[model samples]
Target: MLLCLDIGNTNIKAGIFEGEELIAHWRFSTQRHRLADEYAALFLNLFALNGIRLRDIRGCAVACVVPPLRVVFEEMIQRYLGVNPLIVGPGIKTGIRLAVENPREVGADRVANAVATFRRYGGPAIAIAFGTATVFDVISREGEYLGGAIAPGIIVAAEALVTAAAQLYQVELIRPPRAIGRNTIQAMQSGLILGFASMVEGMIQRLQAELEEPARVIATGGLADTIAQEVRSIQVVDPHLTLHGLRFLYELNRRR
Candidate 1:
């Protein structure tokens, strides 16, 4: 089995794949200061619960946005699993043409999403990742990685609003009963939820217009489900897009 880990700003996602089939997956809060042993122990317990042994893990790969956790994961895999996991970074073989001004600045998760999107949907696609920051990554018709926009994510933006305003409090991320709200809390929720969905649809519309062809829109991330539920433009929501991307890159480079 191949172990795939995706460390985002908010969460650490781990998946155990038996060949190409993902057999077990788990999510944990991202604790940057956690010790390597702690991380290893956590994985060990998870594996035990799933009837997996450490010896069964033959290979591993990771796609991480949190830089501090990189070494942590490297050590965990090396010490516990006895295999060096492929860490996605500058030298990784993604096979996707990146058109960013400074390609190195792009996050590994973003790159992985691009690779997976192209692999699944072919070319001229846009993947909107609803994570710490909502990101829109564009893939050209020729499979080039054209960079897209980044905005504060729905939850982050909502939290900021709640923090800045003295009276407003945090509300559920669900959409308001109607676009026009009857009460204060409902109105605030409606504005943030439906308003954000509208913003996503509007951006996708503009992106499709500017691209070489009508791009297929896909959403991936923790908040993807909430926004995608209301938005009609998002065609697919593959939460494991980045993990699959890492697996693809691992196969590409491991053979070489």
Candidate 2:
């Protein structure tokens, strides 16, 4: 089985694939301070619960944004699975060409998303990841990784709003009945959820206009379902896009 991990700022998305088929997947909150042993224990428990044997894992692939956790997973995988994980980075054999000014500045998760987006949905395409930061990754018709925009994510914006305002407090991130809410919670919900939805719509138009060609837009990440429903421009939302991409990349660079 192949273990593919998409480690983000807020959460770590993991998938266990038997060949090309994903058999099991799980999400764990990102803990940067966790040791290699701790991570291994967590995975062991998950594997046991899923009826997977520790020795059954043949290979592992990772797309990690947290720099500190890189070595942590690397150590865990090497010791537990006895496999050198194919970490998504500069030397990886992803087919997409990065056309940005500073390609190194791009995150591994974004790269995986682009690879999966173009491979699964072809290009010109746009992938919007609604995570800690709302990221927009654009791909050209020829499958080049053209850069996109970034904005404050829904949760980040909402938290900031609440923190900055003394009277405001945290509310459930759900859609309000009306755009103009009658109550405090509803109003906050409308402003955070609907407001981000509107922002997504506007950004799609702006990106499409700049691209000069009609691009297929897709959404992913935790908050994708929450906000995607409100945006007409987004028609596809594959939460496992990054995981799929990591698997694809691992297949490409697997030792012969």
Candidate 3:
């Protein structure tokens, strides 16, 4: 079994794969202050609940956006799993040509998404990850990682509005009964959810124009399904895209 970790700014998503099949997965809040032993304990408890033993995990792959947690997880994997994790960063064999200005500036999560998207769906394809910051990564028909766009995530935008405005408080991020909201909560939801849907559609159109052809739109992340239902442009939603990408990357660079 391979342990795949997708550590983002908001959450840490872990998956245990038996070969290519993901047997079990879990999500936890990202805590930067947590020690290696604490993480090890948490993983051990999860493994026990899932009927997976620590010794069964043969390899580990990590796609971490949180810099502080990288060393924490690396240490935990080395100390507890007894295997050095394949961290997604420089020197990793991603099997995609990065056409961006500075490839190093690209987030590891984005790379993972691109790798998985292109491999699974092929290109031209656009992968939108609605995480801490909503990111759109474009892959060409020839498997080139053409950089896309980034915008403030729906939750982030809603939180910012609540923080800046004195009267407005946070509301549930759901689509209102109608676009013309009846009340304050409805208005906020309309703006946050429906408005985001419109933004996604428009961005997809713009990106497709730049690509000079129509591309398959893939959405992932916690809010992906919610927003994807509202937008017609998003064709696929696979929440575990990053985990699969980690597995793919691990296979690409595994010691022979």
- What number of backbone clashes does candidate 2 have, counting pairs of residues 3 or more apart or in separate chains? 0
Highest TM-score among the candidates is held by which one? 3
- How many angstroms is residue 164 displaced in model 3 relative to the true structure, after the best TM-score fit? 0.8
Error of 3 at 128 (Å): 0.4
Predicted candidate 2 versus true structure: per-residue lDDT over 1-256, tens digit per residue:
9999998888999999998888999987999999999999999999999999978998999999999999999999999999999999997788889999998888999999999999999999999999999999999999999999999988889889999999999999998999999999999999999989998999999999999999999999998998889998998999899999999999989844
| Model 3 whole-model lDDT (C-alpha atoms) | 0.94
Tens digits of per-residue lDDT for model 3 on 49-129? 999998899999999989999999999999999999999998788999999899999899999999999999999999999
Quick one: best lDDT, which candidate?
A: 3
Better of 1 and 3 by TM-score: 3
How are the candidates ranked when ordered by TM-score, highest leading?
A: 3, 2, 1
Candidate 1 runs further than 4 Å off: none
lDDT of 1 by residue, 1-256 (tens): 8999999998888888888888988888999999899998898899999999999999998988988889999998999999988988898788888898999999888998999999888889999999889999999988899999999888889899999999989898887889888987898889888998999999998898889478889999888988999999999999888878878888888997
**Candidate 2 structure lDDT:** 0.93
Full ranking by lDDT: 3, 2, 1
Candidate 2 segments whose C-alpha is farther than 4 A from its true place: none
Clashing pairs in 3: none
TM-score of each: 0.97, 0.98, 0.99
Scanning candidate 3 in windows of ten residues, the lowest lDDT window is: 247-256
Q: List candidate 3 stretches off by more than 4 Å.
A: none
